[model samples]
Target chain A: MAYRSTPLRIDRDHALRERILECALSRVADGGFAALTMQALAEDVGIATGSLYRHFRSKGELAADVFASASQREVDALGAALRGPGDPAQRLAAGVHQFAARAWHSRRLAFALIAEPVDPEVDEQRLLYREAYAELFSELLEEGRKAGVFQLHSPSLIAACLVGAIAEALVGPLSPPARAAREAGYPAPALDDVSQGLVLFCLRAVGVKELV
Target chain B: MAYRSTPLRIDRDHALRERILECALSRVADGGFAALTMQALAEDVGIATGSLYRHFRSKGELAADVFASASQREVDALGAALRGPGDPAQRLAAGVHQFAARAWHSRRLAFALIAEPVDPEVDEQRLLYREAYAELFSELLEEGRKAGVFQLHSPSLIAACLVGAIAEALVGPLSPPARAAREAGYPAPALDDVSQGLVLFCLRAVGVKELV
Candidate 1:
């Protein structure tokens, strides 16, 4: 009976932790990391603040977790697209389009993940995730180079450039100030414009023969 | 007499602040922001920590100032190269080459300024400095487009991509682990390799006619 109850307790704890992370992520998506207070997240998860601390020792740790989880999803999605179909160049273009489109649709979360000035812990995660993105691009670039479809030197370095360009390209339009300006009727680049620009920038960067 | 002394006092205070920032920058250059503790900075400046506090309210504020001053120098150097004599395409290549060369020379400081996990204040400065870099590129991009030497859409967006690409490309080769590997005789891309790769990436990204 004791062994059975121990497993049940472990299951309950795991579920609660997952729920807390989900709520924390939701808060961040809605209002960036600034909105993710312990008290608010606890209430959102129907838990006590003390209990929240029991799960996450500090806001930084929790924020880092959220950042990693969210970033992992993006990496996974981009990896799938880049590895999915068509030629390597087409796959690269599809990956960029999917990334920009997803980022545009969730402007706040994207901005938060990409450029929001937050805890150093989250920033650490950012560096790791940027590397993750570079890895995915490097794989595709190697494939393209081998196929003679992409003319490039140092595929790893080129991959890093692609990661940087794509992230920086999206940071502006998704930023809060830009969001406010758009809401106030100022001119801003639409998703299609950003997506198209990024795709061109990346394809040309990798030395796609046709684009060049 | 009071007014005259007031001016002298203000001059002395300003000089001390500059000295403090110099020391702080040196610390960051040697060991990244992790070595930029307020107490260590005070000792470096031969002043009391309390006196340092009089100059900067907090460590974050001090780090931001250091970040700004260092970033401003890079921005100024880059601006000169980008706005210097030659066609827009030539200037663009020269700028990328110069920027990469400078970062390679000051690997630690460049890493700190470019992608360090530091206080939120420093992160804010990073975002602002990135915009400054983008503005310089945007100006040249517009010039290139008008001169019919470069074919691109959305100079602003393309400029951001260039900024991102250049920063990201250098971050890898300049990072601490990369530095350690290089020092230990690991095969890492040399400065020329990175600079040339980055220049090619940027030129192609902006649609330089010859490169294409």
Candidate 2:
């Protein structure tokens, strides 16, 4: 019989792969993608540099996977918040606030995912994830429109605007220079200020007459 | 006096500097920042590569100046539109439409100015220009708020939202891959569709009661 992989070995392999991804993510979170390197990741994962090649074909592929995994978590979280129990307007507000808060808490990771300039591989993943975020919003927008809670045309386009507004509003505060400025006695706006403004702007854009 | 400069010499020098800037802008517009190089720019301007160094201290400085000059023109044009004769709401709508139309027409240049990833020098100019754009919007927003037209709390925050929305919306359509898709058989959205949607989105975000 051909050599067969045991379940124990398969499980170990899967766990090791996940551990590597976790280490990669933490590196990206601590610094931007610029800090992620194959050798560094291998060392972090406590594996041989040659072993990394077995898990990922290239650095770009690894970076793209890290970006997708992080962004996917965000998209899922936002989706749940938007689709949570409430009126359509309340749900949208909740979703916007949740997204802003999450980004605020993890400013470096958020900036890396949302606005950092990166290699073409990561950049392509960025575009795809941006679309994914927009798609989540579009579904909620459509639901709200059908419920007569939102009076906007083109859910897809409106969703894009919402994504754009959220990213742009947060990028300034999340930037390194902005953080440096805050460290230098420039008071940064509180999270509530940004969240409230973003929610109002997004709700109004969707033609929600009375914000909850 | 030690070798006083003539009026004709000064005029010629000014024109040559302008010419170099023009060539630099075209290079960026054609292929984003990656297409720009001192040697290529000198060839385009019919000057020796050494002459280019005399005109510009470094590539970064040259790129920054090109970015600033191009962005300043956009700011001036947008300022005139927003500050033109009309009520705040009407002027805001006109300004949004004008900006969208201008971006849609020359998408390459628009993408370069709005979203192209570039070196730090150009990126710094990008941030400053973005703030310049937001400042213009903030001024209009203040006027609208004072006139009891806009019901927003923070004009600066709202202005950032507007700029972000505008850039994100246009960047997708202006991206190289999007252009490739359009060339390959995809049907691009009409200019009116994007412009109308964008204008409505901005007006609503600013809490304009009756959209034009």
Candidate 3:
């Protein structure tokens, strides 16, 4: 794969770029997007404002960079969570659980960036993640179908809906209290049940026997 | 129907309150949320700032009120759109088309609210909209299930997916160029195809034959 074959060539000043993003994320976390100013970020990182500009093009660029890093971090984490020794169902379950955990942690930062100038780019990154996620599920469905363990009309579309359901269940255009409710030690039947039910529904929809 | 049978008396002041909301929607349409300010809104409605606060406790309250009105408007529209639908599948198609049109028209405001304060009370309006949308699809799915026009292991979950997919497809979340492309008249094959495939796959899943 091109991704696997791509050679690693880290820039020497990548540490500074990473530091800038960390400062911005911290600022955004502290007081939403209101706190993420160029001067404030540069001051926090102990660098001159002009020096900071050398690393990033503009405020919009900086916001875009921070979002890309955060998005890539999330996608990598989701990818790792889905890659396991278990059957397709187990892998999907692991992915959803891992996603909810991370989403709960970064809900504010994630939502903040959605209103930033970089939202369109973030959306593009999201499509890539969705495509990759769909591929993962489709393969599992194909495996199940071959083994007479799964049956569905279109493995790809089923995969899309399964992935879409889980994604939207957490990050619906509107707020889903499920994430915050679960984290606050509140009993959220809707959130917990939906996660469990989503996996079961996907299996059943694909013509698998009752999920275990 | 309670809605049709019950004619609640409209208070003059309450009617003015609604007038404020109606104008605010037009304002949000003309410019973005950035354009809707207390001063501008008051001026637009020929009211004093003090009078505005009388109806709304604060700016957030005003936003919530506006959101509630807009959300209800969408719900009523969805309900009306699906009422005369041909069959389950046809009704589903009509519902998805209606949803896409509404979401596209209100993209900016929807994006703003989605990323707004995670206030439960504030978001309740949107939650109502979500439920209203889901319910419409649920009815269509049930109609399809009964008429042997659709297949689904669980109509409820399928309905959720259908609504979620339409929303996602409109926003496509990460593809601004795609959104721009759509505006520039890149035909909505992805949109139409996805909705069609989902409904068909759903029907096949439950052992029903697809109807034109």
Candidate 4:
């Protein structure tokens, strides 16, 4: 006899999948992609190794999904800020500031998402998310250009430059050496200083006439 | 008995050391630092493994030295362009154009030096070389600021932004996927377009009143 699906079983399955993803994200956050192993993930989720395969086809697939989920959150946050209520210049400034603050607060996860060396699966996801970010900026840039708020030819290329600048500036400070220095009494750059500078630079790069 | 040093032997040793470094660099350029093993290097250089050790203390030291040497060349090239005969803005524009052109011509070596992940020893050198690049830009920015050719605070920070922008823009086109796309009949951005856009963005970011 064929068994019919039950709502309770469906709910249980969904909850288990969420729990597994949460565990995987935490593992990556704490120890980078290197820390993620199928065996370790199964143990963390209190499941047999064989059962874990039912959820994820392979480690690369699992890592890529985790990367995409994390990156999507960042893209969403940036989108909200950039599309929020304000003039184009002000919105851009606010977006930059928010992005910097979020990355600063979670340096490890930020580094992992932004610049960590990972397997090809995750790297492919990274390339896609980078384009996602540029696409968001591109939309705003097009609007600003139409409104005469920005002067530029290639919105997408300029967007990539802004993303690159933000990543580079933050990566240095968020790197292990810089963290160690701060731990050993070397003062880190204040959040305000970096955010303000980043916003100003990005605005100018996009050819915003009036300073925000 | 302490043997007197002979000039011929010294020259031969120097040449061998150079050969080892050259081989190591080529290996890195071809397959990144992961491909750079002492045994592989010795084989490429046509030397015994024991002889290779006599020249360098360890693989890490050898790798670090190769990284430094390669990076120093880039730093020197950038310095010359920025410090060449021109106004502050012109020199900066010229420097950026030259840098982009050079990196475009040698994508593999550029990728190896700029973004390749490696062991801690090489990473440390990467940080130092990045600072070296920043120092050169800082000097030029200071000159520009004093001459009223540009308006920006924190030359070093701004310098970091420029470096990041250039690296990001080029890395995308230089990436394996982008190359594959080009091979598959996709057109790459013309060098003139990229160089011009990059120069314009950089100039504006520095607050140049009259863009080049």
Docking class of predicted structure 4? acceptable
In candidate 1 chain B, where is summed lDDT lowest over 10 consecutive residues?
A: B1-10
How far does residue A49 in candidate 4 sit from its true spot (Å)? 8.1
| Clashing pairs for predicted structure model 3, backbone only | A123-B173, A123-B174, A124-B174, A151-A206, B151-B202, B151-B203
| DockQ score for candidate 2 | 0.40
Query: Which ten contiguous residues of candidate 4 chain A have the minimum total lDDT?
Result: A115-124
- Mind giving the per-residue lDDT tens digits that candidate 3 earns over B1-212? 36342335346667888888888877765554556688899999998978888777776567667767767777788778777647665666566566555655566665544333322344445455665677776787777777777655456655665555444434343134545777898764464555555555444333444434
lDDT of 1 at A191: 96
**Candidate 4 accuracy as TM-score:** 0.79
For model 4, residues B1-212, the per-residue Cα lDDT tens digits are 88866999899999999989999989988877778898989999998998999998888789889999888888999999999998999999999999989978877777767665555466567667776887888899999999999899878788888887887777677777777788899888777888899999999999999877
A44: Cα error in model 3, Å: 2.3
Assign candidate 2 its CAPRI class: acceptable
| Candidate numbers sorted by lDDT from highest down | 1, 2, 4, 3
Candidate 3, CAPRI quality class derived from DockQ? incorrect
Give the best candidate by lDDT.
Answer: 1
The digit string of per-residue lDDT tens for model 3 on A102-153 reads 6556666654533222323343444555666677777777776786766655
Give all candidates' CA lDDT scores.
Answer: 0.93, 0.87, 0.61, 0.85
